[model samples]
Target: MIYKVLASILLLLVIIGGWSWTEYQSARNTLAVPGEQVSIDIKKGDSFDNITHKLIAQNVNIKPFWFKVVAMQEKATTKIKIGEYVLKGGMTAPELLAVLVSGKQKQYSITFPEGWAFKEILQEIAKNSYIEHTLTDSTIDFSALMAKLKVEKNHPEGLFFPDTYFFEKNTTDIAILKRAYDKMQVVLNEEWGKKEANLPLKSPYEALILASIVEKETGAKVERPLIAGVFTRRLEIGMLLQTDPTVIYGMGDNYQGNITLKDLRTPTTYNTYTIKGLPPTPIALPGRDAIVATLHPAAGDSLYFVARGDGSGTHVFSASLKDHNAAVNTHQRKAN
Candidate 1:
């Protein structure tokens, strides 16, 4: 009877040991190592076996048969999303499963500087890795993209807000540009809400148009409000804006050298000399400060400005036509 009892006890121990080994193998196959960035792409309706092979090929360190079992246990078939994912090592089966199911990729940031035109911004995105397009498609006409965004004008000038934006890696250029347009809309709405009373601007769009002019006129931060004040004052007094930047923008790529008196009188919609009030659209993407400056300009009655040629970048302001003409001849028109 004692010998029989010993045999039964040995059999029970063997069963318990086998059970523990099975659990150990299950856990080992499901868990991953730490600090590794593993990328896996799961296609639509892909079977667990096929996905397992892909992970193994990518050095995921998980066995196919055991992974299927774990996936089944976790009910991951319907939960997995189709996209690229970064799975780290030392992650549990649940954690990796969650990543794949979420279908979220890493987000990257692109910064658009103040005063950049739409074409310039497009070129920047084409060269960015986070933004993708076929090499041939990179030069796609912007008019259609602008149309898709529903911008009123044929050109997308001043529609894209100059700011840093976050996007998924390999994001399309149009996608980033759409975000830029949305950003502009948001910012303009906010600024319009807090606008100062009695300004010459008729609407938020007009304010943006004015801000674009300010952006191209100068890079001086403190001077933005002053510059805005000068233009606003001119508009109120029924005087022509006569800004040089407008002339440059009108010239486009064909601008040779210095703008002559003839260019000032040229009949272009962008020419402040020819047009009344603000230009038909924005000349460039203005920064926040420029927008704010348009809403709340510096208190001044100065009507004219000329670059001092001191290279210090500060312009000399004048209230009289006589002073302005003298400064222009002294600083810019004379032979250097």
Candidate 2:
């Protein structure tokens, strides 16, 4: 009788051990390989229970009770991150926990095109649902905004670098603007120190002004240096810039796409045709190439240019008005 009791106890212990091992393996195995991924947002101040609930709602259908038990055991609740996370199908219970605790939030991207005005940049930011919009084009006071950004500039045009910026959701538009602004300052200062000698520009800001004009003027990449050369030569000779883009910018809301001879005669702070030297500020955001071109213009005798009128978006260079007029007539006739 004693032997039989001992044998029974040993057998029971073996069965329990085998069951526990099986349960442990099952817990570790992939519960369900998600056929489709689902996004989950772990908001700030969310409790561990709330996170578990959110995971379930995101189609992470696993053994919720067991997953929770495992999470608590691993002390993952305290380390959960707050951000957007993607829950995939093939992840096991431990894998899901690892992902949640890893704090790998989803990131989104926004791009500001080269030559985009500060107003247009604001418009883009306001329309982006992911970015937190605390400012608007209509309400952004240049002085106040600059003060807040610690920038002592009178205006903010051409200050922000145009590029694709990535950030997690809920990031403010101001933050993005600040980053772009800082990037432009760094790039401008670095390139300004390497500028070519005898440039008409007196300061980095003046280079930015001309660079903005060059950015708008550059139809072909190769023409950038040539355009810069022409502008620089014109400035050296005290001739009106006569650039159409600056006139358009000056026209602002009144511009109807086409500029007439009358518009050229109209005067504004940004009207290069009517104003002498560089504009009071950059007319638009300039790219790195445009800035570099303005600072280091190619040496040439050409002082005037006209559209090639071959749909190639290229310009014809001329040193004299007679040559420029002849080329203009040829191209204008072709264009007409």
Global lDDT scores for all candidate models: 0.81, 0.87
RMSD of 1: 3.9
Candidate 2 Cα misplacement greater than 4 A, ranges: 1-17, 31-33
Could you give candidate 1's per-residue lDDT for residues 1-336 as a string of tens digits? Answer: 998999999999999989867965665455663456777767677776777787777777666656666677778867787666778777876677777778786557888999988778877887787577643355565576667667766778898899888776667777777888888899998998998899989999999999999998888999999999999999998899989888888889867878988999887988999988888889899988899999989987799998877777778898899998988898877635
Each model's TM-score?
0.82, 0.92
List where candidate 1 sits over 4 angstroms from the true fold. Answer: 1-36, 88-90, 128-147, 151-154, 169-172, 310-312, 325-336
TM-score of 1: 0.82
Mark the 10 consecutive residues where model 2 has the least summed lDDT.
24-33
lDDT of 1: 0.81
